[model samples]
Target: MKILLIGEYSRLHNSLKEGLMALGHEVTIVGCGDKFKQFPVDFSIYARICNDNKIANFLFKSIRKVIGFNLEKIEKAIRFYLLLSKLNHYQHVQLINSDALETYPILSRFLYKKLFQNIQSRSLLVCGDETPIIDYLFKKEFKYSVLTPYFEDNSIEKEFQFPLKYRNKNYRKTFNWLVKNCQNLITSDLDYEIPMQKMGFQTTFIPNPINTDKITFQNIGITDKIVIFLGINRLSYSKKGIIYFEKALEIIREKYADKIEIIVSENLPYSEYISTYNRAHILLDQVFAYDQGYNALEAMAKGKVVFTGAETEFLNQYQLQADDVCINAKPNENEIAKKLSFLIEDPEKINKISKNARKFIEKEHAYKIIAEKYFTSWN
Candidate 1:
């Protein structure tokens, strides 16, 4: 099948495209922003669909101004998207991105009525984390699918995490449409299926895709007197939880002092961080959640003992446990310090977990398995 995958979500398109290729499907990707530099796929043929220009800023501001279905901005954005869509109509496209478009409120009626009147085998695929635009297009019969990032199954914690202020009538209407038109909604954990069903969205179980082959776990061999703790983010203190890591390091430095070193890796000069990871025994990925981002995955691939609360599926596939992967602490410095002490004092346990980390990812999160998952989803 000839497929057009739209939007780039944490290198998801690159991985999925590779999988699709292996399955003998023709795949092209249209990334929204910067393409993942490390992706191993060749998408030059279909890369033109990406709207990487300065217009994104204008669209964002205009959409923000449309608090309650502001029709003027909606028409403007629709004209923009439609022009892009018309330009790329040769390919069967599937738009996968955030669904807060002004087009849904004012322009979707037009999209369903006339814009796509000539187009077939093209539709939008919405991720179910935020407000979906399905509600407005339901009666219009737009081909669509919904995928949810179920953080947990039992708690329904994700919903509560967002406050009521973020809610808008437009958003609610779109979400209601998603619950009705979504071909399927996927959760990483099987436990989430029930909650999704309760919410009136069809649910399926699918783990997060990991490109294990590219992240090959190698033994960096850090057997020395100085223990290292790593924090990986783009040097920014706010988004990557750098402040929390710094506070925790301060507490540990007061006690351990010169015994341990804390190194932070951000989007800095490559020369600066290359050695930092090499010297460290443990890399701290993120404090926002138990799951590891690309940074954590890269650290684990290097065979370093990663202290994180990253989800279990990816780690468990390698026979690694939560205790082994991360310290599983909130952004509390004291809590992080306590976990650090345990790892420093007990080298044997650390070594065991580090060993498990490499093996688990290789066996389970490899590209071969990930590619298959993508194929299953499309089929």
Candidate 2:
């Protein structure tokens, strides 16, 4: 099968493409140029411009790093422009990732309608995320599929992740498009399926695929000090739980004070990221949720016991208990301290969890398995 995946998130397609290729399917991904350096995909489609203007992109992204915006429409508009530039530069096969859905409504209707018609005839469009655009373009005549992120059974993070506001000038139009055109909706979290299903859209469940091979999991024992990694994108601190993690660090240092080491991986060079983890024992994944973000997953692959409060599908897939694979702790100081104290007090537990963490990933979350799922979905 010849598959085309459109999205800016490199990790998303990197794993999916690897999985699809392993299953003997040919895959091509269209995304930003930056993705090419870290991940090599079959084909590359570069989105030339930044949204909100290049200056706005820089300022907004920079400001968003410290604090995110509360304006929904503005946020959605920015995303739309980013994606429009993506489509404008897109020159390849037709399947679309819903990364641009929020912005599609406001897009030049004439161009969108033309593109929709072109895609309808040229390729089987797959919606990777849930957005109104997916619904609008879904038609009986057009072949399409949706695959999304999935959370665990009991997810507190979902409350924060899903947007609730529904006022939009073009929403009804998009909704009507979806009802009339889409064939299926797939979700990483099955919980999201209900809403789509209620809309009478076909639904399926596919967990987020991680490219395990990229993560070099190693077992280099403790050096003189232990490292606790705190890495979040240059995005907002609230959603990523940086503030909570930082506070937890304050408590940890006071309690241990020169006893344990705390290393924060900021916007460092790639070489530094690898070496930093090698020097540390635990990498703090995230605060507000479970499903270790890419940072934690990468750390886990490197044989480090990651500290994350999330327990999403990926965690459950490994059959790992809270303490076995990672040090699951709340954002609160006391809770983080308790979890930290246990690992610090017992060197053996760190070694055990570290070892198990690597083994669990190999057994359950290997790229081989992940690729299979991607292939199955695409083919």
Candidate 3:
């Protein structure tokens, strides 16, 4: 099969490509390296002209803010339009999210319609930051969702922009066009699967693919000074409940300054970010997800106990116990601190969870296994 993956989020498509290739399929990935995180891709649409010229970038941004129209978006739309001829006629094309083209509504609609007509088979990957899923999440009013912080305090303008844009007439129309036109909708985790199903879209839920060969498991030994790593992206701080994690980290540091070591990397490139936390005993990932994202899954594959959203739904889906495989983090500061404290005090428990974490990834999210699933689904 000749497959074309249209976008990327935290190297999800790259991993999937590796899996597909290993299964003897030709796969090509085109993306913008997901902005500064810089995940690799076969074809890159990442534009540096405006961004490299600080003056032009500033002017473009200021103009957008003052006039409610982004010139940069228009430029991206033109670029994508020119790339359309190159993107057509694949056996399969999977958009990473609804906003895969990264353009304004008019251009997005045009590009999506063209791509849908050109491709042999079209599919949608319900990964993070998708407009439809986010809109649905806001509508359902989940008790603790990515939009909770924005709802709790409307002052979060940046975080609130997603819901605002998704609710707009133009964005909604474009989203509906793609949703109706796509042949199959797939979700890598329960976070998206549940909401998509609620919205009356039949979605296939597949566990995220982790390149197990690349992430070799290391047997974590019990050590007196336990290191905990927390990587933060300022843009997603509120949505991922990082404020709560920060509060908990402060408490943990104050209480066990001598026994615990906290390592924090802020917005590092993907390659550097992953390597930065390799020595840590635990990884603090997102708090609002029902299942782990790529980073958490990658960390878990490396035999590190990751504190993420392994809720009851995720546990039952995998038929595994929560505390044993991964730590289910809540939005509450006290509960997060308590969970961190428990692991800090017990080295044996960390080792046990680390082993279970690696095993879980091998069984459920290994790249080959996940790629096979995709092959079957696409066929």
Candidate 4:
């Protein structure tokens, strides 16, 4: 099958493309490199005038401040429209999310209608926050979600512009249009699947594909000092519950200065970010999720003891025990600290979890196997 994937996020589409290709399917991905992380696409749709260049970025920011509209988004929309002629007539087409192109709603609706008309089988993969997920979070359905901080305090609204934008009239219109056009809706994890199901949308839940072949599992060599790595994305610091992890880190830092080493990286490119965590025995991933995201899966594939979402739903789905693969991190500072201290005191559990993490990824999220599942779903 010849498949066309649109958009990238933490190498989700890139890994899926690799998996599909490995299964003998021709695949083409069109994205704007997911900004900063720079995940590659077969056919890129980046704005030439308002992208990456320091001067252009400054000029565009200034323009947006005055014009009340983003110049960069318009530039990307125009670029995506021009590429539409080349993206047509695919056997299967899947968008990473509702805002796949990150363009203006009216323009995106017009452009995406063309793409949808051309593909034989259409799919919309809800891998991140969207209309329903945000709505669900606002209703306080789950015990704790990414929007927990925002609900408690609305002062840091700037940090939540992306997800909050789904509340925009234009964004909501575009989201509905995309859903209406797509032949199928797919959820990549329990975080999305639960809300989508409650909203009465029949969707398929496929785990995010991880290329285990690329990320070779390395047995952790922990002798005296145990290393822990925490990665922070400034944009999502509050949303992903990074502050709790930071507080936990502080506790770990002061109490176990002799036994534990802490490493913190901020907003590095995907290539450098993955490699930077190589030496760490434990990696701190997101706190407010019911299942692992792309980064957590990659870290697990690399045999690192990852602190990510492995809640009851996730464990029951895979039939695993607590701390079998990765630790389940809820949105609490003291609890997270307790979990870290438990691992710190017992370094032996870290090694066991590291090995289990790799095996879990290989069994549940191997790219080739996941690719086959996606192929079957699309067909």
**Per-model TM-score on C-alpha atoms:** 0.64, 0.66, 0.96, 0.97
lDDT of each: 0.50, 0.53, 0.84, 0.88
TM-score of 2: 0.66
1-379 in candidate 3: lDDT tens per residue? 8899987768999999999999999999877787779989887777665566898889877887898887766776677777778877688888887778677888888877777677868888888766667768778556678887777888877766755677778877877777788777889998888888877778888889999998899888755689999999977888899888899999999999999889998989999998899889989998988889889999999999998998888888888876878899999989999999998887889999999999899999999999999888877
Pairs clashing in candidate 3? none
Which 10 consecutive residues of model 1 have the lowest summed lDDT?
A: 142-151
Off by over 4 Å in 2: 33-97, 101-104, 108-182, 189-202, 267-278, 312-320
Per-residue accuracy of model 2 over 254-342 as CA lDDT, tens digit each: 87876687777675544455666677788776665444545566677778888764444434655656677777645566787678877
Compose the digit string of candidate 4's lDDT tens values, residues 17-99: 99998989989999888778888888777776887788988988898899877888898888888888887768998989888
Task: State the weakest 10-residue window (summed lDDT) of model 3.
Answer: 43-52
lDDT of 4: 0.88
Question: What order do candidates take by TM-score, descending?
Answer: 4, 3, 2, 1
Candidate 1 to native Cα RMSD, angstroms: 8.6
By the lDDT metric, which is better: model 2 or model 4? Answer: 4
* lDDT winner: 4
Best by TM-score: 4
